[model samples]
Target: MLGFMDYVQKCFYRASKWDEDNSYANLNATARALLDFPTPKGLKMNLSSLSSPNFATSYSMASLGVVDGSVSYLYSSRPLDNALNSGDVQLKDAVSGYRDLREIMKPDDPRDWEIWKGGVRVDRRDTLLYGRMYLPASTLEALYLRRLAPTRQLKISAVSNSRLPNGGTILALLQQDNGKWSTEYLYSTDVALIGMRGLYNFGFDPRKALPRSTTATTTALDPRKIAGRFSAGAEVYYGILNKSGGMSTGFRYTTLPSNVGSPLTVTLTVNPLMGHFQASYAVKAGEGAVFCSRYDFNIYSYESDLVLGCELWRRKQGDDTAAAADASAAAASGMSAGNIDQTWQPETTSFSREGARDDVTGVLKARITQNYNIGLLWEGRYKQLLFSLGSNIDLKRREQPFRTVGIEIQYNS
Candidate 1:
């Protein structure tokens, strides 16, 4: 017979679906990614190497008529935390043990394992450190992140530059997440700024027992099966040096989809002190394509702006190509391909399994602003190198339509 604690752990695991843990600050991440894709202003190159499972270093150079360069170093206690190179191979053996449990358990049956492997815990142990130094200017920047406990995290970042008012700036953040809610408290040396932000998820509670009703089971067993997630959050900040304070409230609604499909995200935010309001929407318009729009308004100034953007991905043809085409057809017909019958798998496992075949060959992104400024970017891979070429154009300017043009290339080994 399973122990009481074991039973509880099993129940929790069965009822929960693995999802990306994002903080309140990222409430509009999806829309931002689509609308605000960064474009290089000049020539930029990045070269990186993974010396070991937990260590990596990289060099970056940029030329905008004048040349400048930087070197960066990164260290991680866990291989999974290192983004220079995915640690999928290292994780394969670790996840194999859980396959047995998955096979034995029902869709709604809960199970437990080590926190690192997939179990829920109040504390986790992972640390990452990164540092970069710029040439000529001799500017330095560093970042630190540590998971103090399952529910707590500490993040610190600092920058040093001669042109800065204090020759540098440092910001420290303390974060807490308990599945249903997330909060962060931060302090910055610049202006002696202090702030707090929090987000609360509605309609779901992981700590509580799972509901036995069929309708509830559908939602509790898999996040993708749920209608959607609604979240409310707020942030308040004060600057000691400036002796000023401000607050903003926001609401977000998002859907959780399977690996084969893209999710939808919508966000609304208002800053009462500034009399500013903003709304954003992002969604998958079709297979390999995403659409985003944002609106900004200021009541006090009676000013408003609107922006529209879209991204299209090009992938190599393969066996799954037909399936993806079918998915696109389904989407066009007002159906979701993710609703198709498929075995439920952990998020990590799904990512690792589909990592290779899902590689995108190229991407095209374009956005237009209310001011008649248009930006276009094309990113693709060449051999082992990745590159982005972009340009900005001002339609209102007859003398010079092109505002900026640049190219960026990156390689990792």
Candidate 2:
């Protein structure tokens, strides 16, 4: 983790990765630790974990996870949407074989939660103050964990492709606990893009959101129900640099029984500048089958980007059993089975952009009991290729004619 930039630098110097220094790589390494915290309540409080002096110098953070049967709660130093959507805890059943974080907590406790575990940051030799308080109930709607807005913030530097020596940005986010609605507010002082987004979830069926349907009989069903039929949202944006901004709107609709099928998601986004659409689908091959496929398409400039991927999990159940056993053993020993796993996973992903560039990646991973894993990832882009080899302890080493290595040690609690 600490050596991502070093690895990229090595690659660039050797002419193996790209001709130019990848801005994305530098930005990625610059903020990796500060951007995401452990999900389902795993804390990363060590400044050493984040090499950035701005973040690590004097800040503290913690994560707490409370699981009482099927009702689980997470209090973390992160956003609720981030925790619910991509975080470790899974509260939604598979739909067409896809488990996305758009789902919330257990059906019984359906609200999404966010806590502003405040921290101290040193920016440009100045200490700026900011934090948030959660609002348990909102009069604006019949929502739990709603309107966390009495939030306040001060001038903070914004990270962007274009640097601003004397500029800063402020951000605000709002959401309903049940994933029914959400919004974001942003303003930039350094002449970056300022924008606002508002969204509403229209047709998610609570009965379907549950692990099991509540119908009294197999033949009984609700006539008005449809699996998260569609969601609509709008964005109003202005660019300080361009001196012009316009409004844009988008919506996503899905079809497939809320339970299982090759669910197809089609999205359309339109603005004064341009319009594009994306379609994605995912499905389980069949009961007891270990193969699954997920695909995505984005249309732009009359060209499109397509991603095709599949996962073959022959030992999925075996890994689950091993995890359960590890959990039991950890519980008996008064330790957490936080990051322990012994499982094998195999997968492949292929990407084609604008029908000109193609990349294919294959991964093989094996988890050794007591929180260890050995994995290899091979990727070929056009004629350029690279391979990585690693173990849980040693992590990944990128190899080419010249090479760079990064060591990442994940902590589980």
Candidate 3:
């Protein structure tokens, strides 16, 4: 039967459909040849495939954020004896929701894997540098939502808005054209950052407002600024970030800010022999020379299995401009004049918030194995589809934590 199969092949020679097959089919002839294509009774060929130079670029970076999650206790620091006597709020279920949704995107196997295999065929650097894109589009969108900090607590109905806010992504990618076959380093530093998220307002007229300049809906390639409606802002900040891991130590003062704008944002991730931890910090000018800083620390058993951990949050001299409002219940407990108890009255009747402080606020969530872990996020941004919900869970002093939900269909291209 094998001999007859070969004889039939000689009678009808055909152009190998490798190219078309690769485009339409999930797997390719080359892959089949390598993996399962039957060989003539123990025959072997050590032939390698051809690779492309386009994958020569080296760099990668990425960021992971919760689509929606919150952390709060059923206990309150100072529960109002009048309303609901429960000293705390329940947030475990919400925590579990996000925990389950966390996406650990591997290198896009179909495209990037193909690129990886392609880089392997060429004999260039023994190492291929690959990087990832951070979710900046989402980050900024969330940041705006963060300006309100806990969006659920905000008075939006009176604010006149059209679109619901959600999380967006601005990512970067840098992968070695080659694989573990290289020796440069385990990962690449220069990444192609892309942001695939934005914030839409509560204003949607669906109907075009008519072009005001350059043309009357002409489809010609003429010089004009009237293509369509324009949304301001959106600075493009796609660039290579230094390999900031391992040998990196605690904050080393590179320099001070010379401009009046916000300070440089710094992100730190640590992988000591014990666990993996991350911190995000930023600086901004306040009423005086104070530099507001917010820092959080989480240490978990680095082992994928048997992971246990605790987290500490400290915000010393941090900017309040972006702080989201806690829920009505929480805000009413602490800052509201109505809830003020004379026993713990302030020194002055007129006190204004000049800056935030570094307090020992904490939330800890952990899973000994991969099944579960729990932690409280103070105030963070989240994205749904076109709608992004800021402060999915704004865990604050007196307010009960409410889940902020939105929908964001995902696309990884």
> What lDDT score belongs to each candidate, Candidate 1 first?
0.67, 0.30, 0.21
Off by over 4 Å in 3: 1-177, 181-391, 400-413
Candidate 2: residue pairs that collide: 85-101
User: Root-mean-square deviation of each candidate, in angstroms?
Assistant: 9.8, 18.5, 30.6
lDDT of 2 at 278: 38
Against the true structure, whose lDDT is highest? 1
TM-scores, each model vs. reference? 0.79, 0.39, 0.16
Query: In candidate 1, how many Å is residue 156 off?
Result: 0.3
lDDT at position 283, candidate 1: 78
For residues 1-413, what per-residue lDDT tens digits would candidate 1 score against the true structure?
11111222222222232122346887776666667777788998877766775677888899998899988887766663223222222221211111111111121222232244355454335677788899978999998877665566788999999899899999999987776788999999999999999998876565555454668565665444455678899999999999999999999877655334466778999999999999998877665677889999999999999999987877667736776675588567644444433433443243233433344567788999999999898876676666778999999997999999999876666
Better of 1 and 3 by lDDT: 1
Model 1 collision count: 5
- Candidate 3's TM-score reads 0.16
lDDT per residue (tens digit) for residues 360-405 in model 2:
1222222221212222222111122122232222233333212222
Report the C-alpha displacement of residue 378, candidate 1, in angstroms.
0.6
